[model samples]
Target: MSTGELSDERVTAAVRDATAAPSMHNTQPWRFRYLRSEGVFQVRADFGRALPHADPDGRALHISCGAALLNLRVALAHRGLRPVARLLPDPGDPALLAVVRPSRPEDGGEGGGGEGGLGALHPAVHRRHTSRLPFTETEIPQALRTALSDAARREGALLDFPGPSHLRWVLQLVEEAEARNRTDRGEAEDLARWTRAGTAGTSDAAGAAAAGDGIPEYAFGPRRFDGRAPVRDFAGTGRVSGRRAATFERHPQVALLSTVKDRPEDWLRAGQAMERVLLLATLEGLVGSPATQPVEWPDLRWPLRDPVSGRGQVQTVLRLGYGPSGPGTPRRPTGEVLDIRP
Candidate 1:
């Protein structure tokens, strides 16, 4: 892992590991073009992969890229290589998310980097799935919640879980957000573009279709949204006209991850933190899903502010509980996402 001498082959293998990071919809809105001569892996945000109506300014695009960058770091470290990364390396090129170079080489070591219970958790990388399904009434251990909060803090973000008293208000916000999205013509169209079953490899706006990324119909749970746990219904797309409805976890534990300031860098940081929290949850044998419908609306955005902290905008709303982990969503191969420019 020398900055002066990086191989495209080795970088390709690393890029494979980086795609494990999660985004709003498993959009995988990122591309890595490696400059062999410079030994820099240029991480670029694929605007085409973005949900234009949902993320007009490409904030989510940057977050997804940031998550990939975090994965790149972990992948390199897992191989005993510390990659030198410059976030938003070129302001002139806005799509340029980061440039990574395999530097500070070392022997991968005797299972030292990934130690403790986390060592076991590392394997969850391949097992982690964004389950759009509901959880059984099975309760989650309180200890695991502590671990999740710790994981978020490790990446410079905080979690705010609402108490029973605040549940009614929180649900109000979620309802308001849902209502707004239902009427928002642009968002509905954008979702339709991304959620089509035929998008797998043929449809023009197949979005994550070819990549085998994004939520699939099998995982969309029920078309009907049960008020019990408050899960995000991707069924809103209306593509699957008729789908079975299942009983979800009675009380799905929902939490918000946020930063003190709302900015591109902050979103990136929050995204990285979100990935860690998710992986940690996966390690604990739990499933996590996202609900951005509320955060996407201006009217419902600031209302999610935690009463205690009284700061930071809610970047993500997650439903965490014990349930069967999701399936392996599709992804673009290493070659498609990683470019080696000699």
Candidate 2:
């Protein structure tokens, strides 16, 4: 993750490990170019991969990139390279989300998660997937929720969980985003293009003819009340031939990632927290999708911040529960997205 003379092995390892970051619909809208001497990992937003209609303000795009950035950090850590990340280092380089100078644990010490759990999530990285499936009737342990909140807090964000009243507020917001999106022809078209059933993704992993990178028939579950119950319907148009509609759980746990300000730095922080919670949740056998439904709308965005705490701007909402993790979607390979420079 540095510039000057780092080995190709080191940079490639970081990029490969970072791809484990979960993206909304696996957009994976990020590419990294590295400068070896400086140990700088330059993150570029692949606007070609942007779902503009669904994420008009490009917030989810940033969050996805941020998630990738977080993965880069962990990958570096696991490789005995501690990472010193400078987010949005240059305003002139807008696509460059960060520059990481690799640091060894010998320098930065060990994890803030403690030695025991320093990389408790290392295994979960490859295993984590979006779970649109319904969870069991059981509730999540309170202690784990506290731990997830702690993880988010450490990344400069807050996860405001839903109570009955708060849940209602979010349901309405989902409805609002869904309603607006459904009626817009442009939005529907965009979703159709990005959510294709069997088209090959740009990533190497998606090249198999029988495989799928975009949302496929086997996924998409049931219609979330048409307008919105929860979960965005990726296959509502009946693209998948034999895919059946099934029931999701009666209720899904929801949490929001929010930050104090709405600047690029805040967004980067929120994104890292988003990745942390998602990875932590996966390590705990929980799976869910990022519901950036509120962040997509200006009307719903500001109100999403906790009124009392006023802690941070709302970055994302996540629907989480115990269930079958969604099958691995697709990822563009490191070879296509990662560049090494002298």
Candidate 3:
């Protein structure tokens, strides 16, 4: 896999896989520039798509780009090339998140997981989705939970399954955040601007078909009629015609993803770790969704940390279990997100 040997089609396919990574509000706020001469792809943040109200510090934006970077590595490894990634290669340019190039396996690469293991996850990349629907009551096995934590550790982050007491407290924070969102004008506006309507009776993919970004109506799943699941109601105060109400799991299976230090680089690592955990869970017959409402609010976020340890900064709360896989959200075209230079 030399510089000149890497075909344009391969690069395009890799970028396509990268864009499949989830983001806040499904914004897909990332851009890729392939430098043929250097044999590298630069991952940059698209500030135009940034959620100012929800993520004013751009932490979520960087996390979204980091997930895409991980996908690029997985895609290259699946293609029989070892992918090497360098995070924040240039401090002068903050938006330039990472530089990734394909190398021979013998040449090695950064990150813990081997090329083989990463490639094994390529299939799961596209298979994983944010399922907003209700999940069953079955508890995840201890073995699978351990494996998911290992996946996060390999990416320089921590995924903690809170105890009964801690879990109840975290859920309280989520409820508080939800209450705030209802009254916060700025948060409401962000939700409205990024969410789509007019797909009430149509398929999940139909609402996103026009915008190529944002959460669609059908993907909102049923509104939480009862139960303790922390599903976000994208509809806000408005009503979606023909939408049904359902009770979610009473004790939803949840995990908290966090990093030791809360810096830009750490946020990037958290994002990669988050996606790795998600893809592995999907491969192991699980559907999941990210519940970031608590994390989005500064006051509510600090209380989400494990009271026992209280070590890491919580990045995102994840809900995982056996449930219907969420419908695929629309993604911006490859041409729109990628730029190739000679």
RMSD of 3: 1.9
lDDT tens string, model 3, 21-70?
99999999999999998999999999999998999999999889989988
For model 2, the superposed segments whose C-alpha errors exceed 4 Å read 1-6, 106-118, 198-213, 222-229, 237-239, 307-311
Q: Order the candidate numbers by lDDT, best to worst.
A: 3, 2, 1
Whichever of 1 and 2 has more lDDT, that candidate is 2
- In angstroms, the error of model 3 at 262 is 0.4
lDDT of 2 by residue, 13-127 (tens): 8798788787666677888998866667887888888886767767777888888888887776666555678888788978888887776455335333343343555666778
Candidate 1, 104-133: lDDT as tens digits: 744443222554322234556667777866
Candidate 2 residue-wise lDDT at 12: 90
Off by over 4 Å in 3: 107-116, 203-207
TM-score of each: 0.87, 0.88, 0.96
